[model samples]
Target: MNTQPLDDAGGPTAGELGEHAVIEAIVAAAPSSSNGDDAAVLTHAAPNSQVVATTDMLVEGRHFRRDWSTPEEVGKKAIVQNFADIEAMGARAVAALLAVSVPAETPVSFFERLAAGIESRVAEYSAELVGGDVVSGDQLVISVTAIGSLGGNLPSLRLDRARVGQRVVAHGKIGWSAAGMALLERFGRENVPEDLTEVVAAHCAPYLTPGRGVVARATGATSMTDSSDGLVVDLTTIAARSGVSVDLFAEAIAPGPELVRAGEVLGVDPWQWVLTGGEDHTLVATTANDVPSGFREIGRVGKQSGDPAVTVDGAAPHYHGGWVSF
Candidate 1:
């Protein structure tokens, strides 16, 4: 997987420079004071607004594979996950702190590309990378803590806010990530069909719009979350938290041709992917009135009879929920 060995004069290995030098190189272009400070000091644009922060980690061989994703892709995904978390609270992404653990033999170019990826993605929302730390480990591990602003007056959209009789809406694509993972697992990186290229890309690094979560709040969305986990699982979180049940109308969610084609290739039901597959970063929300533009209705919130439940087309989904750590 080495594009060129770090031993080459053009690219140095991490061990060649040692930890302090490696860290200086990694944080050289960072926008935040975290590079030199013992701790980063932050102040919000709207001092009256509430602050929202979230952290996420990606470990090699667990969350991703070097063969399937480039260092930049992994870095971008690490930022996106934390950004999505802030957005889930109906807030604007503001800043990030990164931490990494990599093997001594890793190439220095990998750090350069990874830092570039984080900077590029966060720059979409005018966010900053305030600070981070680097250390040695058996494999690559990335941790990101993203901070966001609610901007004074807007109420945060949370998992516990969905009400019975509200419409459950979605604002991004779904199932493609799962389909992409399936293709990668079955075909590896060789001889992939042209039709599956998009699906494969989704699994590698699903697209995420920076400010969609704030838009959901402005649209009067009662509750919101990104589909980091399976649709049913994340929806179930809202349902349980709000003491409501959610019934998804499968007919309302029309899987695209790409997803259906991937399913056909895998001999599995595409709806299962829609119902249980995750990591699409799709925005799912509930609102009493009509959803805003770019949003679509797929389900409804209802009073929980006894236990909070999530169902598809009035029945339980056959597939298991996604990305179980255990």
Candidate 2:
């Protein structure tokens, strides 16, 4: 059994210090007992139902900006958002592995805090780090692969099931992060509020957690997913996947005062923020009439035809949903 840290033995810290070198470093950090094995071996259980799995990545300067977020916050955000994905499938996150790529000149302090931040949420969610890799790269990028169990139930996959006459609902609030981003644009990192600013941070430093919204699941839901993309796109995904049309109410939007102020400052419509603004990672779901206890009955999912597609108040959306990569 050869036990060593990631930086040694020709890993990131001692390697040629390139992108591949960094990836090798982070990969080497995974604690594989097998000296020459490529993957890990986990304890298996007799097949009863099924295990749901998902993988996601967060890159600096693209997915996140270090100039706006602390390494610790970045670490937690990476873990929580992925966990949110697992929860959207109505599952419980159990463990995760992380791979980090940083410049060779990067201080060890950043790594220390980064690991601490990730570990804090992993522990908070009762997940273990298991193993990971560290390497040198052009910029800091964090890649995480999380594993979860379906709590003795079948995973509620995105493409699993869909039917007409389902109700569309979202847990938690909306437009907060969009409002937060507006604050950042206006305040220039100066006038950030104690509460509202976090939405921006949550967008950048998102804690798409699980425990906060679990109470709504056990009762019932037709289908569900995280609002990572925005209300329109996310609901569109549900409608498109479930093969149904979704209708929403614009005035039904319960805008918080923060978004109102954000709209005022940005000279935009707050209603637009609720429908289109994404990155909040709030829970959005469809139910067959019997909505969950904690979940709000927002709109109904049905056949989309004639006139407006995904109407709010029986009319088409005035604005498109959120931003995009391309």
For each of the candidates, give the backbone clash count: 0, 8
Task: Encode model 2's per-residue lDDT on 153-192: one tens digit a residue.
Answer: 5446463354677777777668776766666656545456
Q: Which lDDT values do the candidates have, in the order given?
A: 0.81, 0.65
- Model 1 / residue 112 / CA error / Å: 0.9
What lDDT score is found at residue 168 in candidate 2?
Answer: 76
Q: Best candidate per lDDT, number?
A: 1
lDDT of 1: 0.81
Per-residue alpha-carbon lDDT of candidate 1 for residues 79-182, written as tens digits (9 for 90 to 100): 88889889888899989988989788877777777787788888887888888888988888889999898975768988999999999998778888888888
Instruction: Report the number of the highest-TM-score candidate.
Output: 1
- Candidate 2 — which residues are off by over 4 angstroms? 1-49, 153-155, 193-195, 208-217, 306-308
